[model samples]
Each structure stands twice: as structure tokens, then as C-alpha cells.
Target chain A: MNEIPQIELTGITRVYGKGEIAVRALDGIDLTVAAGEFIAIMGPSGSGKSTAMNVIGCLDSPTSGHYRFNGVEVGRLSQDQRALLRRHYLGFVFQGYNLLPRASALHNVELPLIYKGLGRAERHNAAHEALRKVGLDNRAHHDPSELSGGQQQRVAIARALVGSPQVMLADEPTGNLDTKRSIEIMEVLQDLNRSDGLTIVMVTHEEDMAEYAQRRIWMVDGRIERDERTRKAA
Target chain B: MLWETFRLAIQAIFRNAMRSFLTVLGIVIGVAAVISMVTVGQGSTQQVTADVEKLGTNVVMVLPGQDTMQGGPGGTADPMFTLRINDAVEDQIASVALSAPISQSRARVIFGNENRRTDIVGTDNRYFEAARWDLNRGRFFELSELQSGKAVCVIGETVRESLFGFADPVGETVRIKTLSCEVVGLLKSKGASTFGSDQDDFVILPIKTFHRRIAGNTDVSTLFVSVRDGASIERTMEEITALMRDLRRIGRGEEDDFEVVDMEQFATMLSGITDILTGLLSAVAAVSLLVGGIGIMNIMLVSVTERTREIGIRLAIGAQARQVLLQFLVEAIVLSLIGGLIGIALGLALAVLGANWLSIPFTPDPGIIMLAFGFSALVGVVFGFFPARRAARLDPIEALRHE
Candidate 1:
């Protein structure tokens, strides 16, 4: 299908430190993702897969790059502007499920909406809806510590989806889960992609987890070693 | 957004309730110390003023020697420098409504077995008028007694209680030194004087009797002059000085042997001393407020470091850097504000208790209260900024990765 790309990156190079101690975290990477696509990035430790996720999530800016999101150059935006971009256009789920330890599941899910300056009633309703989407509406009052690993990840996914963002960025969504819980999480991602037409970019080290996405990208050292479309799950 | 941030800040503070309370303890003590110190100081100043004012603003004292002479002339005391303010000089000052020539000597007065060594003042009927002393029992000595130099005396309330055991001493005879004097009157209790000496601890006798007996000298050591109502005290003092200078035959530029002191000026000087003392005490107490600010800063810095992960999550969820800064800053301010409020209550209670125990007036100064509260709030802002800035500038990725 002919469509404008949702995200485009060219010559993305991110280096840490300087001179003899400098390490290149990202090396001249070029990538493109269309709307409604689910992609997985796989790499070894220190292979820059997380760095790529950060840059794609707008949590970090590349040292030098021409990165575009919906035809707007994201690298040139101010820090606050980038924050606004993340606020309205992107959602992020970390491997650690970084929900506030003291906040309840509902409050955690409503965090992005709170940043968006939504009304209290609107935020409550939207958070309730998001919790229902993850099938955890009954546990909306439970704290993160009270929830299982799979339930916490679902809560994180609900937080990411609460904003109805243009793209979902998940960094090792199933990193801390068992095989059954991981499968459940993968099924939720597959359902969102297939039915809701939501775009997702995920980072994982497991080959089986990577198989869940429609496209798998393998990275070596800071560069993309291979990118190819894979068969959809049965 | 501010409300949400405020709620988050409160939650964060309450999460470590003990730490937050301990952090604010410094502010509590600082505010309480400053408030109580100033309050009690003001109360003492008021007490002094009230006591001095009770001595009568229109009254002035004409003591022997120059005004600088303390303790009735120093070692090798010269009789020439010691003023002989006799009855003749009192009659010469026309600006005074009345004047009393007074002499004093230390003597033991014995009635029965109860005897106390106390000051024995020698004056006339005019002494009661000039000193504004009212009689509580019996009658003042008659002009006839003063002129005939009778051995009758008036006992003060303290002497009456000490020598008579609450019984009237008017008709009783008390032995003063070597002479037996009849107590013709009882003076009212004047409580304590401004300088903290007991005003009701002495007995008064006719000056003629004192000159013939106890002191054995005709020298009047003091002159109590009462200016007429609507009469200018400064002008009267000048007139008294000129008359004394003329009577003493001291030419111009030759220092007079006597001094005239207006009670008003003395009262001002005493109050001024209290003000200076209060200022010094308040300054010393203010230092604790600064120490309190440092305590808040230390706790805030710890909170910022400990909550680094939470800050990162907030930033990642699209919180502006300034919003995060405001959150922590407001938290610190709330802590100090609450502490300041509690301290004010405690300080006022303490001040009232202290004033009661010390028998001084409890003076609550609103200006100091507002100033103390404002200073505590400022302390929070001043000390909380750096930690908030550090939290705001933290890199989201690194913060989220913080263990």
C-alpha cells in the first residue's frame, strides 16, 4: 500500500563519551516503519537495541541524524517540544514496568493523561477504559507490587495505550515473564495490531518473542544486520 | 497540573513520614525559639516601662552629687561633692507643686522579738505628697509633729507585716536603732520599684527627728520634687538647677555638686536598654532558622536522589522539567509552613507560661509572627531550589535505570 511512513530514520549515529573513551551506541542506522506495522528488534547485550528503542520512543535524541515522525523532523525539536511529541504521538513500555511503586494500577494508567492536562473525570473514565482493555478492570485499585508479572506488564501496556498514541514502543515487554505469561502478552500485542491497526516497535533478545511480530530486525554491534518480513502467527 | 503535582508531592512526603517530620524539626525549633525570645523580651520591656511609669512621670529626683555619681559618692567620699539638698532649697523651687527633703539610714527596727534591718527614711508631710505615697492605715504625721520633731513614725506595709505579724502598727512603739518611736501611720504597698528594689520595705519619720537622732546630721541627702500638672519638667529641672547653683554659690562653667533627674528620661533609658537586649537576643535566635533551612536542604537532596527513578518515569510520561522542579519545591515549602505554624502555637504558649512565671505582661507581637512565618517559607524556597534543579535536570534514561 502507498502511504506516508509513520517514522523514518536516516544516518542515525549516537556516540557516548568522547575521544579514546567514546563508544558508538548507534552507528549510521537507516530505518522506516509504515502505519499499522508490528516490528521486533533483536540484539545481544550492548548491541544498541535499547538505544534504538530510546531514540524511536523520543526518550533520547541521536547525536546526528535525520529522524522524521509523521513528516516532522524530530531531532530539531526542543526538549519540551520533544516531550509534547511523546505526550501526543508516542507511548513507551519499559522492560522493568516502571509504574510508580506507591500509585495504584488506575493511577499508573492515568499518568500520561494527567500529563496531557485532561480533566479529572475524563482521566478517570479513560483510565478505567484502558484497564478494561487489558482485562484487569477488577484489579484497577491494586498496587503494582500486588500484581503478578503478567498483570503488571498488562498494566504497563494499558498505560501505553491510554493515550491512544500513534505508535507503541515496547522494550522487552516480556523480559520478566514466564513462557505462558509471555505468550499472553504477545497475544495481547498481536490482537492490538491485527484488530485495532496499532503500530508497535518492540525490542527483545528472545527469538521466540521476536517471532510474534510481522517483521523481525536483527542487529549486530550498532548496525542493523538483517531486516525481513516474517510469516504471521497461526 | 499544579494540583496533581502537589498531590504527588504530598504522597511522596507521606511515604517517608518519619523522615519528613525529622526534617522539619529544625524549622519547628527555629521558629519557636525566635518567637518566644522576642515575645518574652517584649514582655520584659513592657514590665519595666509599667513599673517606671508607676513611679509617676511628673516626679523628679534631686540626689546628692552630679548625675554620674553612683552609690552616694565613691571612696574617700568628699562632703563638699555630696549635695546638701536641705529644706531651704526645696522652698526656693516655685515650679514644684511640693518638694520633700529626704535623708536615709540603715537601722534595725524591733517590735517585740521580730526585728529586721531596713532603710529608715526621714521626711515630712510633703514627702507623702511628693512621692505619691498613699497611707493604708492611721494618719500621716501632723505638721506639728514635723515641726516639734516628735519621735512618731510611719511604717510601710512590709515593716508592718514583719514587725507586727499582720497587726496594725499605728499605735505600737518600735525601737529604731537606739530610739523608741511611735508608729503613727502605715504606708500602702508600692510593690517593687522599677529598679527591682522593694518600695514598701522602709519606715518614714520626721526629718527633724532623723537629724536629732539616727543619722545625727542636718544634711538632706535627696530632694523629691513633684512638678505641677501642666508644668514643663525640663523647665522646672533648669529652674531647680539654677536655684541650686545659685544657693551653692557655683559660678558658670564650675560643675555643680548636685544633679536633677527626671523620671521620664530615666524610664526612656531603661526601656532603651531592654530594646537593645531584645534585639541581641532575637539576632542570636534567628541563626537557628538558617540551621533549619540547612536541615530541609539535606533532606530534600536525599529525597531527590532516592526518588530519581520516579522522576525519570514522570519525565518519560511527559512531565515538563519545570513541573518536576515545582513539585519538589512545593513539597519543601509545605513542610516548613506546617512546622512554622506549629512552632508559632508552641512559642506563644511558652511565652505566656514564661510571662506568668516571671510576673510580666504577655505581649503577642503580630509583626514578628508574620515575619517569622515569611522567613521560614523563604528558607524553604532558598534551600529547596538546588535539589529540585538537580532532579529536574536528570536524564530520563539514566534516572529510569537507577537502581
Candidate 2:
């Protein structure tokens, strides 16, 4: 028996609205990703790159497709089942570094573990370890707004990593950062990919950000325009 | 999981303190109004019962006519209706410890320069026993005075004060309209009756004297009957009704022209009316609770909208939609519970003050307190559902892009 891929999408289509106003956000897309692979999705605006990321994240469902995650049919799962899958298997990081404004860095990072039903002490320790990985452990008690842009994004990354998810999905993780902070975020991703054997899926339009990934998939007009292995895994 | 949700909800509420307080204000007023109104009403009912009980327990009044008029000692006599339970009917009921047939008429009493118009009650020596009247000075009318129909009277506290000032009026004579009656006794003060009439205002005289000189007729309108202790009042009242019907020659099926008014029945009737009034008032006040709940819902909706991005972050971090819903719902409940607590305290304070002002007993009803609190919580659940569902149903993708 052959080992199953981490994620497989066959003939996935996602349509928005209805009638004449209908828009095909993801049109008949097929893709497969192996375990421990670091991939980047790159596209221009209105090319369905973000929509594809949402579909792959299980935050949006495909209109017609087979979505399998680790040998299980995810497309057939209920909303709560998808949530449970996300709880144990996936981590998400957004361009906005979407940490709760009123919550401290530690609390923001503890969110995923809290949903995992981990005890308070266990959640705190795991969140602290993740923050240490992102080099934001010292700023754990500060509110997200009180931290700089780079530090806030680091807290979000810590939140994603705290639950030890099988895959980390980052939607333009450094989109709001300057060159200096973008490099800092890219280095952290590079370190995780190299040292932890963590699977990672990132979406970005920047060529420099895409270069950090070992593989690149380019989307155009709701379909994959190009797929290539750009570099060998570290 | 619920505990964490509750903690998060509380934290979120405290994040915007001013907004939270304003949101709960309506609930506070509503709960306070319901609690205070119910409390004061219960107090009034208790007051009415106590006042009636003070009139003399286990006392039944047999009036000459049906319940056509309202007053303790005054009832109109009809010329055509001829059911009068005479003094002989008093002796027929075995449960009767004391009974007195009373007849009343208005009279202007004058002694020296002081004069006042007052109610003149005519009854036998049993009036003191049945009506629970006490004497402070002088003697009650002797058997000779009652039989001879002599012009002798016992003045109540108010009557004695009006006609004789602080001076003793036991040996003096006071003119009653046309007849001059000797003041043979002074009755003790019983203060005011429940109906606001001064119990110490009426003057008492021998029944025969009142009939021969003042009324010019031998008729009694009310028979005050006090039952013996430990006797069944219902059975006694039934016995009295049967005897009265037989004496009046009324058939078994015919409605007796006279009605027996029991003090217990009167108390129950008065309290029933109070309970209805309290319920109505509390219900009206509960309308404000609805408004308060709506306020909570409105604010919760606004909060969910305002925190769309936060919600998106929570969703992406693997929070179930139901968890989000539970969080907001618990927030609403916490707000109402706090409001209920404060309202209970405020209501109790208001009730105490109202009791003093209204001259009723301060009776705190635990049942009403619990009811008000439980109703407030229900308001939370009922009004909290829509907003929470809206929050839970938000798409994480759209919420992430809300800003």
C-alpha cells in the first residue's frame, strides 16, 4: 500500500451567488500536497488565490469537488466535523495578524489550545513554548496593539503553532510588514520548515516571499496556471 | 468549556464598562419596579388582614339585608324586606359565645357649649363581649337600665373628649337631639377601624332607649356574633344561616334576604384583590424587562459587529460556532443576573420606604424575589438567542475581511 498524501483536491469548483450574477471563485482545480512539504500559492488580484486558500483551509466549501485530508473525505464532513479537523490538523495565520486587540500576547497564543480543551497550565506552557520559537516570549503579557507589527505577527504565528497542527496555512503572513520585518517572519518560517519538519502552505504575490517555499503553484482566473518544484527540501 | 466561555464573556463585558452599564440599566429599572411593586402590594394585603383580624377574630356579622351596602355598623333597612333576626336568634346558635343585636342612628350630642354629630349605636350588655370593646372608666348599663329603656349612654373616647374635654363625663348628662341622656360610662379607645372610620367615635346606648326615643321603631339592623374559641366557624355560620332562614319563614330554595359576613372571608377577599393587583403591576413592570432584554440584544449585536475581526481570529483558531454562540449567550445572562441582584436590593429598599409611607407592614416575600430574578434570567435567554445565533453564523472569511 502507498502512503496517502496530506491533502488532495480533485475537480474542486467554488461558485459564489446565483443566476446571471454567479462568479466562479475556484474553477475545476486539482492539486495534491505531500507531508512535510512547504508550498506557496502566488497570483495577482482577482486570480482566486485567496479564495483557493480559504477553500483549502476548510473555511469555505467547494461547490463541486472531492476534498480529501489525510485519506479522509473532508468535503463530505459537517461544519462541526471540519472544525474538529481544523482543531487537530490545521493552523491558520492571516495578513492582518488577527490577534484579539484586548488580549495579551500569551492569551492570543493560548486560543487554539483553549479550544483543544487543554488545561490552563498546559495551554500556558505550550503557548509559551510557541512564543519562544517566534522569539516573542518576553512580550507575552503585552496586548497585540501594544506590540509592533512584526511582534504582533509573531504572536499570531505562535498561536498557529501552539496546537502542534499538521499543517500551517499563512495567508500573506508578512503582507503588512516592511522589508526588515518581512525577512524576520520569513526566517522564522524557514527555521520551522527546516528544523521541525512542519508542513506549510503560504499564499503571497511577492516573488521574494514565494522563493522561501520549496514548491510554487501559480493561480490565474480561478485555475492553476503553473505548478513547479523550485527547490529541494532542507 | 462553559466555564471558559463564561470567563471570556465576563472579560468582554468588562472591556467596555460604560457600554455594559448602559446596556444593563433597563434591566435594573425593570427588576426593581417589579420587586418593589410586588413587595409593597404584599405588605398592603397583610395590613388589611391584620386590621380585619383586629376587628375581632372569628366574628360573623348577620346583616338585615343582603350584601347591598358596605360598612361595618351601617346598613339600610328595607320596608318590604322583612328578615330581622331578633335577640332570640342569638340564643339559638350553640357556637355563639356572645351575640348582640345593634341598631344605629345619627345624633347631635350637646353638653355645655361643646357639641358634635356622631353615630349612636344601640345594643345590649353583650356588645362589650361580641365587639371586643373595653371600659376605661364608669360602669356598663345595668339590667334595670336596659329593661326600663332609660336614657343612659356610654361615650367613646372621641365623644367623651368632644362633649367633656379632659373633665370626667361619667356622671354628666348630654342632650341627644331632643332627649337628654346621662353619661353612665366611658369606652376605651380602639383607634381607627380598617375602613378608616374611627372606632372610638361612636356612642353606645341601651337598644330599648334607642328604639323608643330616637328611632320610634323596634328594629335591629346588624347582629354582631362572636363564635366560641376552637369552634368550626363554617358550621356555626351554617347553623346561624339556617336559624335565620327559619325565623324569617324563607323556603329552602329561596335566597335569604340577610347575609352573614365573616371577617375571615372579608380578609381573604381583600387579599385576593391585592394579589391580582400585585401580579398586574409586576407584569407591567416586566414589560420594562423585555425592553431591557432588547437593549442587551441590541448591544450584543453591536458588539458582535464591532468585533468581527476578533470573531474571525477565534474561528480560525478552531473555535466551534457553538462555542462562539455560547460565549455571547453567557454574556447576556451575566448582565441580567447582575442587574437582578442590584434590582432586588433597590426594590427591597423601596419596599421598606413604601411600607412606612403607606402605613402597611413591611413584608418581604421571598417567592416574588425568586420569581423576579428567574424572569430576568429568562429575559436574557429569550432575548439573547438571536444576537448569539447571528454571531455564530458569521463566515470567518468575510469576518476576517470585515475591517
Candidate 3:
């Protein structure tokens, strides 16, 4: 890749609790993603792929070692700075379809804009633009309860993209969906990644879903077992 | 952001609808109870006090004892301690404007053929003005009748109505205690007083006649002294005590056997009971509010527990901890505010209704409503705090992991 890495994790480690009760979640992880790279992580149940993703997304801190997002060292950032980083650079999608159930799809998507302290009209216009890009503009006024599982996920994606972040971190995006719906979501994510050249790092276990990404990383017992790049563009 | 939280809070209450209504029901009832009880109690006490003051600023009926007598001490078993000195201290003492003596005795009044049992009040010319008695007929009896013990009297509206009906009772003769007396004057009607005593009852006569003919005594049973400018009641009382002690020839250590009372003194005595009632009612009302606060806390804790998953979802989707806290806190405050508003209306209504029942004008102090609403909102903040903080402090990972 000609561009410098957008996200880099070097010798990162995360452990929970202390001493006898302590459990390691991510052990000595070394990874790098160039600009516009799409990477997927896959593992068994005991693996800490989700923990690793949280660290990369700046949602959690690494116990040891450093994480750099867009060339800024995330490990050294303050809590407010981390929040600022999340606002300015990183977008997140969790497996639970984390749309606020009481909020309209437009409001849910506009949440990050609220944190950014954007004006009402600007945020509304931006949220509608993002929802339109997801092909669910008509459903923007509907609450999450009114939408199906797949459509809710689409609204979530719109929320993630609303702030126009440098990278999108999704943890098991299709984990709650059926096989047919899973492929449809994967197709949407793939189109966004290719068309906008948006860098995305996703965690999943389904082999077919992993095939949509250009690179894959496998984890075993909180450690990276393998890293492979399989589908480089010609 | 606060506005956003407010909107979501309203939405959250609507989510379960029934649960939210049930949760805030305690607060509503408690607020209404406090507002109504205090308002009505305050109104009644105020009405009673005003009525008492309206009786007369000049009248202080000493019923031959230390403890005050109901109505008048009409030949009661208590030892007589009547006026023994030149007790007309107002013209004598600088503090006093005027002084008068009254002795009450019950007797049947006979006018023509009709007869009615009534009280005979024996006093001087000053008694008419001091007791707020206005002449409705010719005039009060001449001052010579007071000194000569003449059989002259002034009748009240009730006595006039019962004995003479529409006839001019003035310039007519009536038999009291088997002694014939000329009615030289009639009194204008004053309404029933706070003690529920009939102010328009009985007859007034010269003190000399009351002593020699009706009551058969030269001593006065009660002395009422009106002060000029209506200030320094204590000074006037002190001088009266000193005057009584000196005139009675009692030793230095002996206590004076008289009481001088005014509106302020009466107000002081009555304020004790009213204050106690006011405090107790307010405390009971406050307890109800406290119970309401506890109810809010209980419901909010449950809400926090119920919305754990939802909280996790929001946290993952870029919602900050403050947003979560503000939402729940706003929900509680809104509930309380609505309850407070309803309570203010109910309280005012109860006060007016109570006033109407008692036949008194109702005036609600706006201060009470402000204080009540302020207290409720404060309760919401204090009680809703822990739950809101708990929601804010929740770990996203752990919350999402909950079943």
C-alpha cells in the first residue's frame, strides 16, 4: 500500500482485575492497517477479538504497549482526548444493534453530532444525508422498535458514518442476523469500503463473512494466532 | 443536551405508560395531602384569630380569677376580686385613654307582656365606646345616672328584638330583676365573635345600678382600660399592676390580683396553639413528601435495573454518561413538578371550600404554594440522584453482558 497505516497497534496487552484473579484479554498484539484497509478478525469463543477491537477503537485502554490511530498515539491520550479522538476519527458499530430504542432513526444517527456540539440544523441535515446514503432515508423518522433487525443495523451504520470518521470499527455486525440478511449487510459494508475508500476493522467468526475483507486476523486464547492478507486488488 | 435528555425522559415515561403512572402516584398523593392540609389549617387559624381581634381592642374581661372565664364570670363560685381602687386609670394614668367597669348578672327582661332571659352588663358612659357599642336610638343614659345609681339601661339588638319587636324600645320602661328601668338607648348590631359568643345579646346599665340593684355590690367585678395610641401594652399592664397592689394595701411580696389583656396579648396566647398546629401540620405534610421521595427512589432504581441493556446500547453508540444521568433525573423531576402543580390547585380549592363552610373570606398566601413546589422539586433532585448516578456509572461491557 502506498499510504501510511491509518491504525497501528504495536505490542499491545490488556488484562482484567489483579494478581490471582487477573485474566489476560489481549496479549502482545502487533498489527497495522494502511489507509482504506478493511480487516476482519475471527476466533473461537474464548478468544479476545472483541477486547482487541475495543482497544483499537479507543473504547478501552491497553494495559501495556501503545496504540496509534491516524498517527496519534492513543495510549497517551487523556480520557477527554480519547473521547475527542473517537468523535473526530473513529466510528463504532457493536453487535447488539445499539440504536437508542426511543429515539428516531435520525436522532439516533445524530447522537455523535450532539457530542460534537454541532448546531441543530447542521446535525439534522448531516444525519439525513448519512441515512440517505444507507438507502433508509424514508425510515429516518421511525424509532428502532418500528424497524426490522436488518434495517436497525443499517440505521446503526448510518449513525457510525454520520460523523465522517477516518475509520469504522464494527464488532460482529451480522452476529444477530440470519445467513441471508448477513450477506446483505456484508454487501453494504463492502460497497461503502470500496466506493468511499473508508477503512474498516470488523470482528466476526463466520468464514463467509470474513471473505468480504481483504485481510483476516485469527486469535486464540487472547493472542494473535495468525495474520494473513488474501485478496489484494490487482 | 439537557433538552435532549428531557425529551427522552418524557419518552421513557411513556414507554411503559402504566408503570410510570403507578410510580409517580405516591408523589402525587403525598403532594396533594401536604398542600391541602397546611392550606386549610392555616386558613382556619387565620380566620379564628381575625374574628377574635374583631371583638374589641378595648375589652379585657377579668372573671374574678387567674384563668380566663368563658362568656363572663356570672356569679361563679370563684372568689370575687372586684375593682377596689380608682381604677379609671386611663384619665388618671398617662398610658390609659379611658377605663370602665362591668358586672354581669343573668336576669329576665320584662317588656309589656313579653319576657326574655338575658345578661345585664352594668358599667359607665365610657363602656359604650370601649366595647364598640354604637347607639341605634336616642342616646346613652346621662352620666348622672351612673353616679346616682338611677334605673336606666341600654338594650342590645337581641333584647330589643325579643321584648319589643318593631317598637322603639328607647324611652320605654323594662323590668329587670323585678326592678323597673327606663331604656334610654339601643345598640347597633355587631356580628357573632370568634368565641361564638352572641355579641348582640343582653343589656347595659349604669354601674351604680348594677351594684345596688342587680348585683347588689359596690365593688366592680371587671375593669377594662383603653390605652391611647394602642402601643406599649406591657407598660400599661405594669402600671395597672403597681396601681392595684398599692390601692389594695397588699404587702411588697403579695401578688397583684388583676389581669390587663389586649389584642396583642390575646394574639400571643392564641398563637401558641396555632403555631403548634401549623408546625405539626407542616411536619406531617413534609413526611408525606419524604415518603413520596422514597417512592421515587424505589421506582427509579427499578428503572435503572430494567434499562441496563438500553444503557449499554447508548454507551456503545456515542452517548455519554451525563446524557444517561440527565435523562433519568429529568424524569423524576418532571414527575414531581407535575404532582406539585396539581397539589397547588387542590390546596387552593380546599382552602376556599373550607373558608366558605366557615363563612369567612379565604385568602391563600402565595408564599406557601411557592415553598411547597420548591420543596417537591428539591425532593426530586435529592431522591433521584443515586439512581441517575448509578445509571451513569454503569460499565458498558458489564451492562451489555447482563441477561
Give the clash count for model 2: 0
What ranking emerges by DockQ with the best candidate at the front? Answer: 1, 2, 3
- Report the number of the highest-DockQ candidate: 1
Backbone clash pairs for candidate 2 read none
Q: Which lDDT tens digits does candidate 1 get at residues A1-234?
A: 667799999999899999999999999899999999999999899889999999988889999988999878997777777788888988888889999897899999999999899989999999999889889999999999999999999999999899999899999999999999999999998888888889999999998888899899888889999998877553
Candidate 3 at residue B310, lDDT?
78
Q: After superposition, how far is residue B30 of candidate 2 from its true place, in Å?
A: 3.8
Which of 1 and 2 is the better model by DockQ?
1
lDDT by residue for model 3 (B1-403), tens: 6776677777777887788777666666666676666666666566567655554654444434463354355634334555445464554578777777777889999988999999888888877776667888878878688779899999889899999989998889999976899999889987555455677888888888888888777767777666666657677777777666665666987654556566656765665676688678778777877988888899989989988977765665556777778877898888677677777777778768866665555777778888888987888898899999999887766776665
| DockQ score of each predicted structure, in the order shown | 0.61, 0.57, 0.29
Q: Residue B309 error for model 1, in Å?
A: 0.7
Winner by TM-score: 1
Greater-TM-score candidate between 1 and 2: 1
Candidate 2 has a DockQ of 0.57
Query: Residues B1-403, candidate 1, lDDT per residue (tens digit)?
Result: 8898778778877888888888988888888888888898898888777776666678888876744344454533324322245445556667788777888888999999999989999888888987778989899999899888899999888888898996878899999988899999998887766566778999889988988889877777778888888989999999988887887788989986777899888888888887898788778778888888999999999999999999998888788788889989999888788778878888899999988777678999999999989988999899999999999999889999999
TM-score of each: 0.86, 0.77, 0.78
Reported per model, the fraction of native interface contacts reproduced equals: 0.54, 0.69, 0.25
Worst-scoring 10-residue span by lDDT in model 1 chain A: A225-234
> What overall lDDT goes with each candidate model?
0.86, 0.86, 0.79
Which residues of candidate 1, in runs, are more than 4 Å off?
A194-196, B66-74, B78-90, B105-194, B198-219, B248-254
Q: Candidate 1, DockQ to 2 decimals?
A: 0.61
